[model samples]
Target: MSRIEKFCAAFPDGDAERIEEMLHGYLWDSISVRDTAVRKNMKEKFYHGMVLGLLQSRSDWLVRSNAETGEGYSDILVYMPDKTGIVIELKYADDGNLQ
Candidate 1:
């Protein structure tokens, strides 16, 4: 198994692809993140991926999950690279209380 695959196995509830997407976000965000070490690592990998065309500056992708699992709202939300806005609305409202 790939190194990422092995790491992801520990997060059985997480999709490997989703983790990649989050990593992509972490690598590409315009603002600097707090940790220098992690930033350096991700930046190197991201640049390599970009050089090889594995990732692009603007790509349409979304990380979403809706199921009985405790994943909750989108862990990462990505807009289409085309800059089109997609709307999500609730047909019903939830009470402030959680069981």
Candidate 2:
């Protein structure tokens, strides 16, 4: 199945583990030999654009970028037809330290 199919399967029930698994697949699959910046100094914007673009490819879910959530702006916001929402926050790690 495609990313959207996997994501749709994981969307309901609000299972964070499955959603994160989808994120992992996306993050890894997105890397390519043409994109060497990731190994050098890729910024968070790259991730944001790629993810946002992917989310926007499908019309079944509502997708937004830099969405305002009363408290602050989210990196990406996705809402299902049933009104379920997923807030995605992208983080960049430096010097191989994820913490």
Candidate 3:
């Protein structure tokens, strides 16, 4: 079976399309982080994109961000239907060529 099929089996009545839309929008918005904060912002945004992508593609998942931390999270958190949560963390590096 396809991955979506497996995912959907866990969430019979959820809208997969809406999940895709949210993931697309979240990823598209993340592209704006180019060189400004370079190291920090890109990693955080990429991690966030991954979390959002999962939330969007999988019906049995609900995602949330902690506004209190204000971008200091290890990664975005995704709560899955299996009653488990995932924290996605991203790390990036500069080769000393773009100082």
Candidate 4:
């Protein structure tokens, strides 16, 4: 089974709360270290690297960054055979208006 499949088997309903909790627990120190190093200039690449690092153990999933799609490029793409894929678009909050 794929990593996502195992996750779904455990959570069954895409549990955002549990996922967030797990990520926060795993990434808190890494993010803090990155924050201390970069201070005010934290970029999307940092977060992307952290995510990639965290998910590196999921060998069944194909993870890519800055992949070109048809019309544009995707920041991150997580693919699993015969299952749902994940596309992430990374954006810096200070660069554009999110409202």
Best by lDDT: 2
Question: All predictions: root-mean-square deviation over Cα?
Answer: 14.1, 3.3, 9.2, 4.8
User: Candidate 3, 37: how far from true, in Å?
Assistant: 12
Residue 26 lDDT (model 3): 53
Write down the worst ten-residue block by lDDT for model 3: 4-13
RMSD of 4: 4.8
As for candidate 4, its clashing pairs are none
Candidate 3 clashing pairs? Answer: none
What's the residue-level lDDT of 33 in candidate 3?
51
Give one clash count per candidate, in the order shown. 0, 0, 0, 0
Candidate 4 lDDT trough over 10 residues, lowest sum: 4-13
lDDT of 4 by residue, 1-99 (tens): 754344433322456566556555656544566363564456666766766665555677687888999999997787776586877665555545646
Where is model 1 poorest over a 10-residue stretch in terms of lDDT? 85-94
Q: How much RMSD separates candidate 2 from the native structure?
A: 3.3
| Candidate 3, superposed: residue stretches over 4 Å from native | 3-47, 66-74, 95-99
Cα-based lDDT for every prediction: 0.37, 0.75, 0.53, 0.62
Ranking by TM-score: 2, 4, 3, 1
lDDT of 3 by residue, 1-99 (tens): 665455434333355565445545755766565523455546646655565565466655676565234557544566676676555444444552433
Q: Give lDDT tens digits, candidate 1, residues 10-87.
A: 233446566456555645663355433454335444343332232222234432322222445422233454564222
Report model 1's TM-score to 2 decimal places.
0.21
Off by over 4 Å in 1: 1-10, 30-99
